[model samples]
Target: MEKIAQPQSSFMKLCRKLSPKRKDSAAESQHIKNGDHDKNRHIEAVFAYMDANKDGRISPDELQKSFMTLGEQLSDEEAEAAVRLSDTDGDGMLDFEEFAQLIKGDDKCSEEEKKMELKEAFKMYIAEGEECITPRSLKMMLKKLGESRTTDDCRVMIRAFDLNDDGVLSFDEFALMMR
Candidate 1:
């Protein structure tokens, strides 16, 4: 079969940097450290999602590595907390399936995060069709973060991250801002 080429978008450029792989993945395997990463196709994508090392099955250490891979500023306390919350099996370890289920929110999150986005549009609209977080504009950004974060909160975020002083947070900066 002939392979089809996928075009890269400006947004894809950033996601490629963050995710850096094709959406389709291979099968999953049990031998994680041996470099036999993906034995299950969906699990493989999940591994790619959670596996910073591209080494299958996320260990406690791997979870931290995953955050850093995103260039996120995560403190030890916060990272450990999130890992513990998602670790599930209580083995003090998180396998690829475990990692996938958790990020997918395992029935906890109202919706599943099936697709990945590097576009500023998706980031701004993670709140999901809410008017406050309208797509494609700087005007409603803060209100989108929700009722918990007031206008003052938005101002505080802008002040902290609007590095270029452009008044608007670019997709890269916005991703970091949520951190």
Candidate 2:
């Protein structure tokens, strides 16, 4: 693969910096020691985006719409359930604190379950009988997600997350990128 000299977008830089290697205890401990302020800031940004009406709360409709914008089909019932799970004050909406807590609680899922979800997502970009994500597969997935990038751009993205330097993303690399 020919290495392309593409300027990294801020989002891409953040993704690159945040990509965790398998069992990188040092990085994990650093994130914990720093009090996860960056993570909290990201959560706050997401909350702001989901609060479509700017009422300082996320309603079920807003949640559903926000997820839809991200290409995830969040049904109304599922959104209501999510709000109920986090709406501690019985307000039927998610305030910033409640939203933060809800996201934090997502970490409670078992490692096995998380791995299964990651595996399923990884499968979306791989061909039948393939075990890794090549630039071609990634380009196709990115196009499906409404982002049009050249194959070289996809190669650059894969290189950013390809810890093994093999010009492709294995399941472990994909899991690390998701982290």
Candidate 3:
């Protein structure tokens, strides 16, 4: 028992008014079904993940608040930085759904190269100096490995893990490096 997909009657009427050539140009099956709707639902799910406010859209304010709510308070400066960096649409606000789509859709890798790149990135970011991965060892490893980054002249590496700005790397933030 397969399901079916149906365009609204209004859409069907509009299609009929078009010339035969135009009518079939769209080539929509009148009985289209569940799979199409399922795709829409998946889209909604992605949107929901990014919509912290549940306001139906993802505004910069909402995004900032969501991050802030997650204990990552963005100073006004940081919020501005984030918006400038992430609001790809330049729409001045991100809809919850669109924002969700952006993150998931923003795969900066070709599938074929993903595994190799991931391995290299993990090797650089992770510290396995000791029997197990540990924060102290990880930081040291990053600082040493980052010495050769394009900005090789400066010790600007390993600074990103100090989430609290406490001049020390926390355990959880170190874990994020695995990502």
Candidate 4:
């Protein structure tokens, strides 16, 4: 039987940079030292893909193009704005270190901190002196969270966790939903 060759996807093309036969010098090893070995390799692959010209820096044009590839269609201003958020050295471009920081996120919040943060967020959906999120407010909050829910969807969601049948979500209920 003959084996058929499959076309390489863009992702596959990016990953090809990590072929086992590829060798890196001491300079490249420095970038790999910050993260788990396997994870660093993947990050490096993605970084290389974003550095479209292989120029070692991701300019706004390159970042914009990468977003366009993902169907996000970032405008020049939007792309520059994104770069500025992480452009630590202010060169108007992102080096691998800066890019990695942007992707890895800030994980400094502890569990208690997260709970307190969630409580604060939950409070935003409730009225003053109220300890629960009303059905209407819940619907509005869900929309703010990028969820497109109908009135029925909100009612069903509340019914699922409205332990007291008060047609609202108490902090305990909200915490359960968050978890």
Q: Best candidate, lDDT-wise?
A: 2
How high is the CA lDDT of each candidate model? 0.43, 0.66, 0.39, 0.61
lDDT of 2 by residue, 1-179 (tens): 01111111111222222222323235576567454765666666666766889999989898778656544565677777777876899999989998777666555556665666566567767866779999998887666545688999989989998998999999998877776
RMSD of each: 15.2, 9.9, 20.4, 16.5
Ranking of all predicted structures according to TM-score, beginning with the best and ending with the worst: 2, 4, 1, 3
Per residue, candidate 1 scores C-alpha lDDT tens digits across 1-179 of 00100111211322333332323222423345442332244445535655556655566566555545433444566555555665777876667656555544432322112233334334543344433222233334323222245555555555576667755555556545433
In model 2, the Cα lDDT at residue 157 comes to: 86
On the 0 to 100 scale, the lDDT of residue 71 in model 4 is 34
Instruction: State which candidate, 1 or 4, has the greater TM-score.
Output: 4
Could you tell which candidate, 3 or 4, scores higher by lDDT? Answer: 4
Off by over 4 Å in 3: 1-46, 49-53, 84-90, 109-179
Error of model 3, residue 135, in angstroms? 19
Those runs of model 2 whose alpha carbons end farther than 4 Å from true positions after fitting are 1-27, 30-35, 123-151, 163-166
Best by TM-score: 2
Q: What TM-score would you give candidate 2 relative to the actual structure?
A: 0.68
Question: Per-prediction TM-score, please?
Answer: 0.36, 0.68, 0.31, 0.42
Off by over 4 Å in 4: 1-104, 145-148
Tens-digit lDDT track of model 4 for 47-127: 887899998999889977874654335567766766777789999998999876655442343566456645655676676
Over 1-179, each residue of candidate 3 has an lDDT whose tens digit, in order, gives 00000111111211211111121112444524653454345445534544666877665565456444333344555444444444667776556444434433433435434344334333433345533323454444434422222333212334554566654334454444423
lDDT of 1: 0.43
Better of 3 and 4 by TM-score: 4
